[model samples]
Target: MDNIAGFIFLCGLVLVSATQPQDEILNNFQQVTKLSHLGLEFADFFQNVTLSDISLADSRAPNEEDLLCLRDLTLFSNALKERKLWALKMIDAWGSIPSGILTGNRHNLGNYDECLNINKDISQGVTIRGKYCFLQTSLSAMLGSDIGALGVVTRIKTATCFPASCSAAHMNLFVSQVLQKVLNLDIPSTAMGISDASCQTSASEPWDGLTIFTVVLLSLMGAIVAVFTVYDYFFCKNHNELPAIVKAFSARANSRALFRIVENTSNPNVISCLNGIRCMSLFWVVFSHEYTGRFFAANLNLFNVLPWSKLPFASFILHGFFSVDSFFFLGGLLLALIALRTMDRTKGKLNVPLMYLHRLIRIVPILAVAILVYTKLMTVVANGPLLQGFSGETACETGWYWTLLFVNNYTNVKCLGHTWYLSVDMQLFIISPVLLIALYKWGKKAAAGIFVLIVLLSGCLFATMMVNNYSMMFFQNSFSIDAMSNMYFATHTHATPWLIGFLFGYFLHLNKGKKFQLSWISVWSGWILCLAMIFTSIFALYPSTQSNTPPLTTLEESFYYTLTRVGWPLALCWVVFACMQGYGGMANSFLSSPLWQPLSRLSYSIYMWHLFIQEMNAKSSRTNSYFSDYQLMLQFWSDIGITLVVAYLLYLIIEAPIGGLDNFLRPQKKPAGVQKTSSYPIQIVSDQKVHGDGPSKLKETETIAQTISE
Candidate 1:
């Protein structure tokens, strides 16, 4: 009769698997089976096992997939309660009773997977916990309620199995066998997956004592600044005693400044083409970071959904990386142009110290403020599964000095990850004075030698990177952070564009005001070649950006990295040269448009805060899933809008005020004997008045033109 019953139970198991629709849980178990190597009938083994021994450990009651895991665990554990032979079968299948848990340093034993907190949760507070992630919640406590696991054997050698030692041999055999078999059956992996699932919490950590304190301090300071700014802007009547705050953010003053910035041909010493290029580059950066900024966000499954090679025409967005080169190119160009002009004005001499000081003054104040806010604010306002250990204060606070010192690119420490650009640019500025002085004093022979040296150094560096298989990316393209630290972010490797910019700037400086007479074909061809170089540089990495395509070979990577970095900057020089020489047609007009002036003014501040806004958006995301293009675009726009407001505030309070404070506080120096004709990188002036004591005010453009006169 017992044999018939067992045979009938076996038939029921076969019938269920054969007739029922395939369950996803069962599929998971099957997938995990490859790791188990257990040779047994899953249906028969499940029939004997039950889940009554389950404990969510300290985890809250399970939900969705987690609930399914607990349900399955209970089913397997319960089956072992009645079937003695099944326990031996499980022992044979798993090889032995599994020990330990899947927490740190114990993911695997010699041959079997561990059954982490199942036995221990009975004594802990294993109640039915609701689903709310605490800042310090343990992984074991999130799966469900646990009474102790049911005893598998009532007696061993006719003694009661009360304290569990009497049936130690059988219980160890049965429990270990059951746990091992269950882990083999897909329970441990499922339970372990709790670590990967998206988690969120609305409640703030009270232990964030420092965050609260910082917020209060910042609030008080902000209120004081705000009140003072308002009073100075509206209430202060005397121009002689004008506060810098009124001069910086005052609506009446800034309105006139904005108008001057947008006036076509207003103070045309600076190439208006730069306005468009800077603005466009900044927008591209925002667009690119729209997707890449989720370094720690939910998977967003972009590689799967938006595979790179498969796209028909919009791959340029992926290559927004070229924009950084454009910036570097522009930096080198401006540095060479201004340095040469300053030396020419100063009798072939440069103020190396003042040049350095001016650059530091331009870049550091806003940077320091942004870092301070990012480190302190993130802990209070945001927290998410992806941001668990990466975002906010911990990512950057210790390394503020490295960034301030302009050596951040060489260090593994990062306060704001994006600040690597600031470090690189600052370092380039520090070094540029030496090169500028050399070129000014030494002439063309020096230029030729330096040019050749640059080519050789760039070539050699790229070759080494490719040979070492440096990932060449701060993103998925990199193999390791160590490699990215040494290769991608290094000043030496990225200096190619900066160096090239100097050459272009020198060329433009020498040829300024010279009219060129070229045939129509020559003009057209120059434009074509320029366009081709840019398009090719931007799109060169299209094939490698996707997951399906194989990684670029060392030769291919070396060639493109070498060519593109050189090509993009050279193309920029052409645009500037052609425009100045009256050869640039539509490209120059569009680039030189006054519409870009305001955006250009905001570009640096925008770049600084765009990533911070992106992180905030990602952490606060309502959907804990892969990002789709539609979703990203919407957030991208939202991020831009918010960033603009924040950037404007930063510019008013910290950035624009730097020059104003100096102008307002110090005794105005009389026009330092006809200063050289050069475009200041940041110059917002009124039609008649320059800010404070700026460039003799109403006569600024005439003065600039006169200073450059031969």
Candidate 2:
């Protein structure tokens, strides 16, 4: 016992002795970097500092004592001192103590306005010529607390005023040196260094090559629009001959097409409820994105926001990711319905290449325009402390081609991250023709095989979840990019919902114009079950958000994720099926209303533009915003209003004109004997055998292209 006690005491003594040098080095660093010492030095310098004195030609240099102090501070570790000597010298020569070092806190940002105000006040008696820089660092989370761990303050936004001679590169190098030398740790290069791009100085920045290119491209587009709009008014409207290109870009003609709403009362096969569903789903997405922006923004009361996530009513916001699945379902339904109908009319001679081309033309142009605007123009239009952090310019610049190719879900770059849905949707569309053709040739057997394939895909998703230990809840503390890329963003993992919609589409096609009489109890029961499934899918993970509740096991998470992915679509399937069959009652009347038509027409444009708008709003903030339900709703409505106006303009300038061109280029030929009864352009004639039975015929009618377009 005496030997054991002596040994323990000796080990403690050895540990304390070893820590003393590290403690001394840290203390020296703190003394050198402390706010009070730096403030006194800055005050003394300010008394003698003048515009000409601090000019690039004649900037003040570091004092000999300060340089010696830094050298002596690191002398205990010969290797560290030798390696960091240049960094220390550069920092001492060029760096100023950042204003955020004094005024910033974990809960609030440093006073950005005050920092600039101080610089302005200091230059009052002299020729105002100092540079104020916004230095951003990515290591704020290393502060070590629950708040830091949650990544609520993942970045440190600090300001520093330096002489015009202290270039942005010098300031960035200074910050990097201070962090590296003081932390005394080998931080990852990506995480510690402040890049030149991340530093914003008050100096007027010159236009870079990309910015100049963007300007030229936009000017050319504008010139084209102006020329075409003028040409369209005088020539196309007066019955004069014009080329297809002139007619395609006519704003006058496109606006008429955009505002015109045709109700297909005669076409009972049209799914009218889909318009409301689409518009509502898009609004939900915008609302969710607003919350996401707030969550990521510099919020003063981020801890308050976390508690709201636990509220029962907040499940709608928390689980709004499922809103994306709604689009997946709709995409599959429309593709299957249209493709199957076209195949039936053409006797399985569908033009697959043209179909793909048509889809690309419809989607890619607007997406490209959006990507260009986000990457090149956003920084030019907005400047603030947070702009560089969330602008995603770097990602978009490097990986935009992947996004354009509709394969960015697999890429690490998350340029316009929400666009992953488009990739998944496009990937699904590419493979859909195979299934459509198989269904046309083999009917129920193909569907049965496809169902089995969906199950297998779900199994793969479950296996992925188990291997990675991903949580079912998306907004959890442990949620990561890996979880999103593998499951939420992956085409295979999302195939079940989309394929389920395809099956529902097939079901709808088989029973089109057929009526089923059911007892009132049976109809009510179906509605109840459908509503229950949807509510369950949304609210089932609420418990996981609560502090008192234990985390879900891997088995539980996998099961919930797999089941909800399937169940959410199944519920939506019932709503569409019932509404089409006239059993939807009041629900049908509300969903099939004409009010949803205009908004639904703009749904695609709204989805493309809403996030961009939200990003601009969040990043343009000059100070930390307070998070609240009312504030979020206010922002959401404001975003929606701006989005509506932008979406309409986009439709007028791009989507509608492109759509008109698509129609003009691919004109549908009228059958020789058939008379035109409606103004709608495209028509399909369906007369095919069902299950190898006798031919089942329906009158030649207009295709629900507009309905599918929504």
RMSD after CA superposition, every candidate:
13.7, 11.0
**Each model's backbone clash number:** 26, 0
Give the per-residue lDDT of model 1 (tens digit) for 85-167: 43333323222111111111111111111111112222244321112211111123223322121111100000011111112
- C-alpha TM-scores of all predictions: 0.68, 0.76
Judge candidate 1 against the unseen true structure and give its global Cα lDDT, from 0 to 1: 0.53
- The global C-alpha lDDT for each of the candidates, from Candidate 1 onward, is 0.53, 0.61
lDDT per residue, candidate 2, 1-710, as tens digits? 12212212222232244466877745644543433323223333333433233222223565553343233322312322354332222222222233222122222233333333322222234222234454443443333323434333444434444433345555444444433443344434343344545444455468888778877866665566668878888767553455667756776665554455656464756677776676667667788778867775666565566678888878888778777667667666766776666556556776667667766777777778888878878878776656764557889988999889989878888677777767777788788779988999999999999999989998999999999988746557677767877887778998897899899878767776778888889889999999998899878888877999997888998998898888888988989878877798898888777676666666667777777788887876766677789989898899889878987777667666665566554655567664332322131111100000000000111233322222
RMSD in Å for model 1: 13.7
Which candidate number has the best lDDT? 2
Instruction: Tell me how far candidate 2 lies from the true structure as C-alpha RMSD in angstroms.
Output: 11.0
